[model samples]
Target: MQAQIEILASLQTVDREIREQTGRKQRLLEDLRVTERQIQAKKGEIDALSAAWSEREKLRVEKDRVFQDEGKKAMDKRMRMSRIKNAKELQALQREIELMRLGNGELEEELIKIMQEIDAIRAQIQTKESEMAAMQEEWQKKQDELQVEINGIDAAVSEASTRRQTIASQVTGDLISRYELIFSRRGGTAVVEVAGGICQGCYMNVPPQLWNEIIRNEKVHLCPSCQRILFVKPATE
Candidate 1:
């Protein structure tokens, strides 16, 4: 019973370490997820800007074509005016030329505005793309480091689990099963010492007989309050 109690104690130590490692791994994974989400958000911003820039570029091209067509029409009308035989026909042609010229001027202004907008959009795209690149590099480094840490944690957890199994095997089957149940129920604290006639697992007072049984170390005893396995440390140890 003394040796069994010692094995249970050792098993508890390993189990606690395993739980801690598991928790650390989970936290690291959550951090990695958050970082990835941020990276995606940055990419989304760049993609939206890129789409806008593309649309603006298309509009600019179409406007330039329209401007060129209007200029050609104006020039053609001026050439036809040189062959006019009537004053009224000449005046009408002149009026048409003036209207076309005015329309072309407005188109020119619109084209200039579109060009300015395109330049602004391009600049924004450039800045955002650069920012995204830097953000990705930074996040990738953090992710790599986190992955390494997670791997270390995994290795530690595996080792602790193996150690737990080895220590648990030295204990009785029924005791080991009960310890597991109590460990889960008691928040990873399945075994605890009796101190000052109190159950250290819950700080509850232990009955005199129970305390004596724990002192005897004859068999596994459970705390009445918390149901955790009770043990007593050797005075020398």
Candidate 2:
């Protein structure tokens, strides 16, 4: 019975450590996911800014083309004005030329505004790109470090798992099965030490007769309240 108790206790300890290490690995994995998302979001921001810049650039280019076309029309009309002989015809031609010139000025003004907007958008895009690059670098470094930590935890968990298997093999089949069942149902604590005639597993007092049996340590006992296998440590002199 003492041998069996020792085996179960050892198994429980390993199981607890495995659970803890597994939890740590899960948390680290979540952190890694969040870190990756942050990098992606930053990249998305830069993409949106770049798209805006491209649209502005296209508008500027189209406006520039229209401005040049209008300027040529104004120049051509001015040259035709000197060939008119009739005063009324000359006045009409001059009015037409002035209208063309005014139209050209409006086009130039609109093109200038478009160019300014394009320049501003370009500057903003450049800044965002730089920021994204830096953010990616920072996140990648963090990911690498986190990965190393996660790998170490995985190795530890694997080692503990092997140890647990070895301990389980040393115990009888029925006892091992009972321990596993209790471990699963009792939150990884299948064995506990009794003290002061109390079922330490549930902090409830055991029957005095049962406590006496547990103290004997000649046979395994279960806490009636919590149904956990109980043992009593010998008094240290």
- The worst-scoring run of ten residues by lDDT in candidate 1 lies at 164-173
User: In terms of TM-score, which candidate is strongest?
Assistant: 1
Error of 1 at 93 (Å): 2.0
TM-score of each: 0.83, 0.79
The best candidate in terms of lDDT = 1
How high a TM-score does candidate 2 get? 0.79
How high is the lDDT of residue 88 in model 1?
100
Model 1 residue 163 distance off true place after TM-score fit, in angstroms: 2.1
lDDT of 1 by residue, 1-237 (tens): 878878888889999999889988898889878878887888898889889888988999999999999999999999999999999999999999999999999999999998899899889889888888887898889888988898899899998888887887788768888888989988999999988898888999999988887888777898999999888878884
Query: In candidate 2, what are the lDDT values of residues 1-237, reduced to their tens digit?
Result: 888898899899999999889988888889778877877887787788778878878887887888888778777877877787789998988898888788878878888887787788778778877877787787788788988998899899999989988988899858888888998999889999888888778999989999888877777788999999999876899
Q: Quote the lDDT for 165 in model 2.
A: 85
Clashing pairs for predicted structure model 2, backbone only: none
How many collisions between residues are there in candidate 2?
Answer: 0
